[model samples]
Target: MPAQEDSSTRVLEDLDAAAVDYATRIAGASGPARAALRDELTRICLPFAGRMARRYRGRGENLEDLEQVARLGLVKAIDRYDPERGSFTAYAVITISGEIKRHFRDRTWGVHVPRRVQDLSLEVGHASMVLTTELSRTPTPAEIAARLNVSLPAVLEALESAAGYSPSSLNAPAGGDGAAEFGDLLGGTDSDLEMVDDKLTVAGLLLRLPARERRMLAMRFYGNRTQAEIATELGISQMHVSRLLSRSLAWLREAMLNDTLPRWEGANGPTDPHGMQIAVQSGGGVVTVQVRGEVDRDTAERLRTVVRHAVSSLAGRGLVIDLAAVPLVDAAGVAVLLDAASAAAVAEAELTLTGAQPYVARILGVSGLQSLMR
Candidate 1:
């Protein structure tokens, strides 16, 4: 029995001599004669290739397919073999083993994985198997890492990525009774979860507002009352209630975004001590309106009125608003500029604004007026 096993496993000396002779002959001849020589050499080496392929039989691949891969590797070795380099047996063994391992590494993954991670996963898996046999139990990641001289995190990552090798389908049954699928375990996006930060921030901001503004906001929103009803309850005009609500809401939005509170104007008007002034000059088919001082809610209407007169009085020419002296402009001021641009458009006149301060220019840019700037 021992002699028979040895005879079955042993490679013949004539096979090596034939391979070297065939490789030399095939390199110089490319016709049907060269192909016949290569085919004959391959038939002689079939038993040797089958032995290499059998080493990987139980590794989740069919034996016949592995043998085919090994045979293909043998053909490549024959084509590439140089007679003076080394023995054909050693070269063919390396090539055939490499081809089989390459097939397993590249083709069997159910999910895409990095080559490094896949290699590490195989190392970790082998280590776990060896340690399990020695320890007589399933080895932990730490044990595998210690045995392989790798970091614990690396072992853990390898084990986690190994799941990608054979990922279970989302539609697959999750339990013994098959009542639920794996997809049933996933949770959906919660709509209110995204608003948690906003709600917390608004709650903190509402506590910082004045008593009257806070009370009015609660009455209008939480209590669901009209502005006129709020005005009557607070003993103020409905217009005043509307202005206060707009101002408070604007301040809250600014505070939430910028982390700075906007200055709240007095009941009479904006707190800007320097009142706005508008001076218009006409020359050379151009009307230039020179503006001075800060433009806010209270002063925006005056600027709007002056710009309107300039637009209506144009005689087939252009209008230029010089803002060199203007220091600051609010949202209301920007609205007036947009209104002027629209009226000029309707009159078939071109309007250009020039010489705004850096801060005021940024405000205009944020207000979508950058195209009109000169």
Candidate 2:
């Protein structure tokens, strides 16, 4: 593909001269004229996402998949864009970034990112969101640890995964009475009728989730048990259950964001994205959880499912994340903490981690997540 150097360097106004030609081609949308213009437009927007893509290149398991994500953003910008909305380059850049973020979020739920990893990442995001929502500002890493009852380092580690990421809120509308908002945290999952059928509904999306995530969702959402109760039922510690639930909610969130699932002829299945992760959770009323042992990638998925479930089910008003036996956590382990943090935010629970190691604190400080706690 030929590069549009002007779109890469020159201003949008200057690019307008070229835009006019493409506009005609897009408007034409019929023949060779349209083909040439579409190709040209793609050429122009592709490079805008290069810088952001660089950050996740080797970091992301699939580089080709990442570029496709970037391409998806570029196309969306060209399609919905107006030449008048400032520089086309700037517009493309924003669209590209949005696309990349969306990919990360989706990947966090659906694929290249394991369901467990995404769940943990979601927790960190949720914690940050909770701080911002409750205090109307960014809370420091210390506050998060204080809230979860964990040590300063654990909180920092959780925050680290969310360094360049921001948390997203469910657009659940305000009720008519506008009653106590936090009190409403005691409600059930707000699944729509769309999830009832065998296609785009919650059940269908559940198929995409990993087996552990699927089972937890069932016991929690369909069983109607508290987090602690579920923990007893599953024979896992209450904290383990809590962490799993929290991760589950994050996956459900990602799945919910995927409103459309393609259905094949005679096959009611959605084609999984090239790279993805889908967060989903909701069930029960209140929960208390307990966790032990050092967390790593191998065990991270279990942790994520637990945390997400805890949050989505509104298991309790507060969460106590006990890290007493956890001696060391790698980068992947930190990701799991983030997962629980994100869920706790939505469930309106105070998440605290207890007995963090000095080594953990050093990791958190190096990651620059200390600022998220108050």
Candidate 3:
């Protein structure tokens, strides 16, 4: 025991000497020498930062981020450390721990909390640690309140706020075998499936429409072809095309609201086709395609087909695709748009996109398609 104590004393003395040397150099040196001394000091104290950071592990924040925070705190402590006032290690531990606590208080709260409550939460935590150490047991809220000279209710509130400091991930492992995630145990309806149901209902309703009306609707909405173009293509007068479009849209709206359409006859049911409604309108040498519903791999082919048909028929006129009603667009859908744009460019026609949802717009921006959007 005497030999061990001697060895421990020597190690501490060496650390103290190093700290003093670093401090003296840091204070007296200038320029490159000062930077070198700071680097040396940081290297010497890195282990202390790591030790302090380890105390904050398993608290939701990444270990690497916490270590970085602790290192920052160590640097601050070293710059401000007064050897005449205290031991360097003790000062560093306090500063590093404070930094970790501050990180939790400022950033880790999943919800907004009052500043008073946030500060109190930290105080309560410190009190609990002190009480736990002294009593050799986990401290109750009442014990912590007494130790901190705070009311029991305040302590309880602080304790509650502490839970917000580290919200667990829903994807975290839950079951013993780790086969299930915490999200699997949570209860909530899948909203995307609900959207799929609505789309399927719409598809069923579309199937009820006549083939001519379906083709006209597709040309007007998806091909961005005007009533004149649709009429010319269908061998009908412009007035008749307008009347047909109005009637078809009204029927679709009523069918969607009242569920008046019969079920789809497809073997795979309503959502099997997983297609979107595209209406094209052409007038004054411009074609507009209005796209509705999700645009993913399954629906992208239909989009490509309609756009290609419209671009071919437009004779170099501009094309505008309105996507206000499109809730989602995947990579395949984006690819289809890019390919259509390329085709239109090759045909010496201008293509403009409008009414993209924020998410779709972000995707377009990221994919370098923002230049094509109007």
Candidate 4:
């Protein structure tokens, strides 16, 4: 066994030596010689695929998707690498992270969890953030447990879950306000600016959510599913889905809505306003308002304003309020929505709700809108 193992190691060493030689030659040459580097890059990046994939084990994202994203990042790093500046590890780290961030910004999750659990996830994240900042470094689970007053196992669990979580995406363009955008988080590189917009960071928000709620949010948003469909798929009552949605939306609003500029926002400005999308202006019937946090009565009031603004121009078009993407909302949302629909009707427009969710649907049904919807 020892002889065989040594021989296998020597064979690997010989292959590595030949690969490096080929890569170094390709790096110095132009044109077709660059082709030689491709195989070497594929070989070098094979190991990184697992490491990055491991980082994403707990989040509800698909392993295949994670591996694909990581692989693309690795390839990109190899292609764009410049030996003039730094080590391969540093470059690869940035590359893999950048790719992951893009996925976080653009992709939705594959599973759902509960609202209380979602909020707990957020609290755990906050605790980690506070502990990291206060300690000026990453803290052990025991240390985190001490600070959070939770069990060490809980702290470990949070860390493990968060390991798969992508940091908030910074996809806004440079300088709507010139510095309040999330693109600033990656140090305002023109290259990074082209990635997904920070405003689209629904993925990171989902990770902060409780596991079950996160799963539900994934199915609803990414799946573009109707409440009834979601209910049937999850084997739960539509009313239950609606309720879970309401709670989760409130949590999402809390995670996504911001008053002060986030650290990343200092360099990248806000995205093109909601009205800039051709979909919004061409009467496509979509409205995106930046509701600050916690979709309770107050946020619901704000949402009413958004709904009014969205429908003000369409005037009798099918009114589809998109709540499929939010992380939280509450019981008050039903009243606000019903009121908005009434207000829209008063303006002589019909409101055809598309994403009423199970809980929200039940609330409306129980509140006497079932016959109206039918």
Candidate 5:
């Protein structure tokens, strides 16, 4: 027994002496030779590192990963170890253990956790285990806090943070039959969210219309009344109600798109000259208004007058506006067209706009008067 103990002591002394020589030589050596010597020493120390690694096994980390961490710590110890400070074995043991613990503290958590809370979590876990063994049951937060000499809140916080260490997968089955997942319990998209902007814009535009038009719109839409019902309530003909509702809604649509309200024509609104000319003809009870120039804010009133007169004497016949020579139409022109269409509806006559240029056609389409296009 004495010889065997002496033999073990000699082996330990030889290892310590060899470690000192390697450290001394590495400090003085440079280039590939120094690297070769460091590698040789690392190879010798690997068994010791692996032993240190095994102590931390079964603690929720792979044994191989912990061994790699320990070996990394071993290399750091060799690079930093000094002969005068202490024994190589003792220094290496501390470094390797610290590296393994740091791997758990920093890398094992599935989510970001404060370092203080992480350390407290370990303590709380240990205290729970001790109390569970002693009391033959899981310990409460207060009991665990008392065992760890901490506040109950801290213990509870640590317990909560423990879940972040290895979070359950969102795709994991939440039902016993595996038909549903955890993510299925989450809320879906709000379909009405897409219409929020449109609804708001329409609301503001509705306020800009006259009270009579607004009431007609509310009765026809909000109150779910037919054109005849709204006309009866307002003591107007169904055709008149149709005209007002059409005009109001079309104006709102144009306002929403342009982000500006177009001027509504009164019986005597001022007119300007944009080199515009209008010619009206009647034959077989079908009146036609031919326009020749750009129809804009400056000339919208002139066109409105000719179309209104044609509709007034229609006597249940159709009125056609020839836009073949018209070059362009603006928001004001679109408003006039909507008003013309409304007037024709009230007169029980169909109003059609024909031969509009591509640009003018697009303007009418966007103004919600595509139904008026021939």
Candidate 6:
């Protein structure tokens, strides 16, 4: 035993010397030099880490994971340690133990408990074990609380929280017969089945729209193509695309809410030199209007007109204005959205603004029209 003690003391002294040297070299070193020194220090400290990790071996975590945690803690301690503070061994032990405790606190909790309660539980557990050994009897909560200089209620709460340390698996056996699993006894209902009729109705409605409108909807939503890309493909101005899109969406909104087919007015309409393009699609009792280009003083009235048309035509279905492609929106554009929202409210229909670009969203946010967005 004396020989073993002598060997242990020598090993500790050597490790401490090595730690101080690494700290001094790492302080002056940079780039590859610092990295190599850190690697060497880590190797020297690994055995200390393993020793610390062994303290937590019987816990739920794998021994290897705990060792890795301890090593990480050692690396951090090495980086942060000042040789002036004291011996490396003491600092390493504290840092390594803290890292292991943190791992257990963060990862092992089956249910979330307050950090204070978790810490108290650990203290209470350790104290109870010590008291039980000393007294040769189980320690009461009051005794543990007095020993720890805490309230009895706090001790009781900590003791109660011990059960949450390890949660039962969902796959565990449900009963003593072992015929059923816990998961088998649980019940759930599929909510998606409720929307089948609505989906079918929307699919039929989509089929009735003009071929051009259908293609535009497919490209915008399915292909995820920008309005500019769609405009380039169709050889039309982005503004023209916006208007066509809006008018198309408004018509579909009217049809779905009224449960009637829309009369096809040919796609050709009066061109605006400074107006946004609008595309509309309807499904599942909601009509989505895709607006592109700028919405400022010049084009705000056009937006109001198109949205008002949609609101007027719909009986009860909701309308969503999508502004994902609109690069800019000003005060006038915000007014148009507010007006549309108010009109929808009066009509007893919900209006939602969807996919506004950042600049456009910021404008709406400043104007307090953000509440209308979904």
Higher-scoring candidate on TM-score, 4 or 5: 5
Scanning candidate 3 in windows of ten residues, the lowest lDDT window is 263-272
**CA-RMSD of model 1:** 17.8
Error of 3 at 145 (Å): 2.8
Local accuracy of candidate 4 as per-residue lDDT tens digits, 122-237: 45665666788899997777876777677877656655555334544466655667666666556434765654555457666555554445667778987888889987776656
| Candidate 3 per-residue lDDT over residues 8-68, each given as its tens digit | 6776676577888887777777889988887888888788788789886765679999999
Instruction: Candidate 3: list runs displaced more than 4 Å.
Output: 1-12, 122-139, 147-149, 167-374
User: Candidate 6 on 1-374: residue-level lDDT in tens?
Assistant: 99999998998898889989988888788799999998998898899899899877665679999999999999999888888989988898899989888888998889889989988887888788789999999998899999999999999999999889997787999999989999988888878888897778777777766556678888998899989998878655576567657867887777767855765443222243444688777888987778876676657888888898888877678999998877667667777988898999999999888888775787788888878876
User: Which residue pairs in model 5 clash with each other?
Assistant: none
Error of 5 at 332 (Å): 57
Candidates 2 and 3, the one with greater TM-score: 3
Give the candidate number with the greatest TM-score: 1
TM-score of each: 0.48, 0.29, 0.39, 0.28, 0.44, 0.45
Clash number for candidate 3: 16
> lDDT value for candidate 4?
0.59
Expressed as tens digits, the lDDT of each residue in 135-221 for candidate 2 is: 998888777666656677655654554543432333443466655354456568767654556345566667765555467678888
CA RMSD (A), model 4: 30.6
Q: Please give the CA lDDT of all the candidate structures.
A: 0.83, 0.59, 0.80, 0.59, 0.81, 0.81
Clashes of 4: 41
Give the Cα error of residue 44 in candidate 1, in Å: 2.5
Models sorted by TM-score, best on top:
1, 6, 5, 3, 2, 4
Full candidate order by lDDT, most accurate first: 1, 6, 5, 3, 4, 2
Return the TM-score for candidate 6, rounded to 2 decimals: 0.45
